[model samples]
Target: MSIVWYYDFISPFAWLQWPKIKALAAEHPITLRPILLAGILDLCGQKGPAEIPAKREFTYRYTLWRARQAGVTLNFPPSHPFNPLAALRLCIAAGSSGAATEAIFDWIWGHGRAGDSIEALAPVAAALGIDDPVAAIADPAVKAQLRENFDAAVAEGVFGVPTLSIDGRLFWGDDAHEFALACLRDPSLWNEPEMQRVAALPIGAARQA
Candidate 1:
């Protein structure tokens, strides 16, 4: 079982979920896979939440409240959804270089932005020591690698941010992280017939929904 994090650099909800997901992953011995949120958007032909009228405003405040509860600090990404191509390249570069890609993902989600200039990304790149990510990202080889990452994510039927994949099943949202942790650490959580339907509901949804 693996946590396939499908999040864009610009998404507030994904940003809000970052710390808890990492904490959960560390507490459990689960593998974390960071997939491009842009690819998910492409597959769905959708944009960021801020593009919607009510949802944009509503989710912005809602995200802040959740962030407060989650103990995460986030700056709203710039107006336009930042490009994930470079970010994805950087991720692949870090992974290929034998560094902890999930750590880099944590940084980006916790604070970094695709809208940041290369100069802004310099410190993180240096810290991760991925000095050549820009070059690597521009190279045909690494670009192909990034493409493969996106393609693989799509092939797995991922269509949303923070989607966790256990075996072949998918669970989405920060609200679903507990089930993800449960399913990952113990398959018994999903071994029952009724478990199938129960896992489909959101966290606390059995009570609320």
Candidate 2:
């Protein structure tokens, strides 16, 4: 089976889930898709968790706790919600390989560094063997690919990062990792009556904007 993981470097949850997703590569082909999380939020008319003060604090605390429990090293970059375009475009420039993706994630989440400007991404680009980080990421094709990835993710109904798409099914968020594995092991899990019922459950009230 092949799994497409839609991710943005700005997300700590995506960082936390990377190792587990890598482990899945042992048995399944994993595609690392780099996208702009900000674009998704714009398309969905939503605010990112960091945009909300309370949620921002909670998200940091919660992700930190989860990382500790999972024995993963996680340190927030100098800032949350930093521009991820440079990093995302760099991934495209580097061919979007698993190693390239992991290295970028490590730069941001593991090493706790910003990934916004050319200076911030220079080391990562050098490590990936790209002689000219600026020229590589400045290629029109690289920019277009990142845009295409964002559009494709939106078409796939992806509203968040750290989403795993497998066999036409999407399992979102780090918390859904185990559930994704279960469904992957048993494709029929989604066909259960309750699953179908909840999928079609109607909204009783709509909040007015």
What residue runs in model 2 are displaced by over 4 Å at the alpha carbon? none
Q: What is the lDDT of residue 208 in candidate 1?
A: 34
Cα lDDT of model 2 by residue, 31-86, tens digit: 88999999899989999999999999999999999999999999999988899989
- Residue by residue across 18-128, what tens digits does model 1's lDDT show? 666667656554444556776677678887576678878888788778778878775564454555556556656666332444444455555544444445565667777
Clashes of 2: 0
Q: What is the C-alpha RMSD of each candidate to the true structure, in Å?
A: 5.8, 0.8
Q: Check candidate 1 and list the clashing pairs.
A: none
lDDT of 2 at 179: 95
- Local error of candidate 2 at 3, Å? 1.7
